[model samples]
Target chain A: AQSVTQPDARVTVSEGASLQLRCKYSYSATPYLFWYVQYPRQGLQLLLKYYSGDPVVQGVNSFEAEFSKSNSSFHLQKASVHWSDSAVYFCALSMTNSAGNKLTFGIGTRVLVRP
Target chain B: AQTIHQWPVAEIKAVGSPLSLGCTIKGKSSPNLYWYWQATGGTLQQLFYSITVGQVESVVQLNLSASRPKDDQFILSTEKLLLSHSGFYLCAWAGDSGNTLYFGEGSRLIVV
Candidate 1:
């Protein structure tokens, strides 16, 4: 069984400030990691994903994440956050042979961006 | 382009009443479908999943069931609604080993 852990429950940043949300996973095989964001009254949207190759992956809204196998971490980062970036972010892990392609997700980090 | 659709954006049901939620996937064949529940101010929970037609797998059985009657349609149902069942229900579909899942608008259920 695989699981994900998000160390931070809430992360606050001021406008134009850099931000990073930490995520760690526990899986036997090479895990597929993803970051998703959810705004108020909206569904979860894909932020970025890391399968293999490059340790760092870029996503929309100037968001990026770096995967470290040694540390088993995939942390989402942004150079500068805006007030509109306030939302809940989730870290998920998926495996190829898993039944039904079920994904294990972290509890999520609620981000608050102040202007 | 692939998309998933879930009906009844918001529904209110009484305790002990029957409940049903529908989901449909487009632009893909034999895709993997999933039903997820999110409690108020809580994390997401996997409820059910369907890989192929008529093959449904239960993840968290909370007095609820899921069925895939057709290739593009999936249904979530329960015999009786409970206050605990009141939450946000999301429908998602994935292909190619669930690399990325596409989500629907989500259905909000309020058990009164």
Candidate 2:
């Protein structure tokens, strides 16, 4: 079966500091990868996605994710953090096969930015 | 642009009561619809998906059911609610040939 893993349950970062959220996935074949962000009381919003080509993809809010087939990882990164950037982040994976397409999400990582 | 809407932004009901939630999509036709549930601190779990009207597929068994009576509408309901059903319910739709899902505002359900 396929699954997503977000090792860090919670991360605390200072404002204006660089941010990185780690993600690992388990799948037999190349998988469709994605990064989503959820604000309090709000539904998730897509940050970036990787289907094929381009190891790095840029997304909204100055967020970017790098897809590493070798490491089986798709980590989200940002040059500088902002107060409003504090939220829950999720990593997802999908493989389009005979069963159609559906997403399997990771446990998610909550990031808190102080000052 | 495409938009998804979920009704009854929030609901509070007894454990054994009945429940119904609705979702509608606009600016897209024949889109793939899906129902996702999130526990208070858990990740998103797919409950059901519908590729076309009157055809719904279950992805998880949580004592809940979903239906797609119209191309743009999807409904999630349960004859008897359980306390474990309390959480956030999100509705999403994907474009044709693309697996990228767009989520709605979401509905918060509290079953006491």
Candidate 3:
């Protein structure tokens, strides 16, 4: 079974600071990885996804993620974060061979940006 | 231009009462629909999925049943509601098998 692990439960940073949320996956095959963000009382929105190709993929709102096959990691990074960027982030993985395409998600990391 | 809609943004129900929730997908054909549950400020747990009309797969089976009557409509029903069933329910769909999913706004249920 494919699984995702997000190590940080909560992260706080000042505005204009760079941000990185760690994510690790356990899967034998090359998995489809994704980053999603959810605001308070709102549905989750996709930030980006990585299937295969270049390790780094850009997403909406100036977010990017790098997929490291060797370490089985897909970490989300942003060069600069704003106060509006504060939200819960989730890393998810799905096996390519799995027909259902069910996504296994991490526990999530809550980000708070101080002004 | 795919979009998913879930009705009744929030619902409050009593234990033992019957319940029904509806979801509809737009701008897609024969999409793979899914139902998920999430606790307050928690992770999403897959409850059910439907690959096509009239077929539904139960993943959690938390005293609930799902049906897909049309190509774009998925409905979740329960004979009797439980206090434990109170949570946020989300509807999602993928353009095809093993494709990326899009989520709905979600329906918040509070069972008392």
Candidate 4:
């Protein structure tokens, strides 16, 4: 079984400040990693995903995440944040298989970007 | 472009009431359909997924049932509603690659 853990439950950052969300995964082999953002009362939007290739992957709205196989972690980062960036971000893991591509998600980190 | 729509944007039902939710995918044929449940202030749990019509697979049973009636339609239902079922229900679809999933706006359920 695979699982994801997000260490931060909530984070508060001022506008124009850098932000980072931590995520750790437990999987025997390399797993597909993703970052998704959910706005208030809205469905989740895919931020970025990583399988192999480059260690760092860029996503929509200037978001990016790095996959570290050695540490079994995939952390999301942004150079700067805006008030509109306030939302709940989730880290998810999916293994390549034939069985419907099920995803296991982390508890999510609620980010509050202050103006 | 592919689009997924979930019906009954929001619904309020009493406990023990029968409930049904619908999802339809447009511009995509034979896409993998999925149902996910999210509790208030919590992560998402995949309830069911269907690769083709009449072949639905359960991921985590929440006393709910799902069915793919058509190539583009997926339905989630339960005979009786529970307070635990009060949350957000998201409908998603994956293309042939099946690497990434696209989600719908979601429906909010409030069970009293």
Of the candidates numbered 3 and 4, which has the greater TM-score value?
Answer: 4
- The collision pairs in model 3 are none
Q: Which one is best on lDDT?
A: 4
Q: At residue B66, what lDDT does model 1 achieve?
A: 94
TM-score of 3: 0.97
TM-score versus the correct structure, for each prediction: 0.96, 0.98, 0.97, 0.98
The local lDDT score (0 to 100) that residue B77 gets in candidate 2 is: 98
Among residues 3 or more apart in sequence or in different chains, the pairs in candidate 1 whose N, CA or C atoms overlap within 3 Å are: none
Tens digit of per-residue lDDT, candidate 4, span A31-106: 9899999999999999999999999999999999999999999999999999999999999999888488999999
Q: Which stretches of candidate 1 lie over 4 Å from their true place?
A: none
DockQ of each: 0.73, 0.78, 0.72, 0.90
DockQ-wise, the better of 1 and 3 is: 1
lDDT of model 3 at residue A26?
98
**Native contacts conserved, per model:** 0.63, 0.69, 0.51, 0.83
Tens digit of lDDT per residue, candidate 2, span B1-112?
8989999999999999999999999999898899999999889999999989999999899999999999999999999999999999999988637678889989999999
Per-residue CA lDDT of model 2 for A1-115, tens digit only, reads 9999999999999999999999999999988899999999999999999988999999999999999999999999999999999999999998876253689999999999998
- What lDDT does candidate 3 reach at residue B112? 99
Per model, state how many residue pairs clash.
0, 0, 0, 0
Candidate 3 local Cα displacement, residue A86, angstroms? 1.1
For candidate 4 chain A, which ten residues in a row score worst on lDDT? A94-103
State in Å the error of residue A110, model 1: 0.5
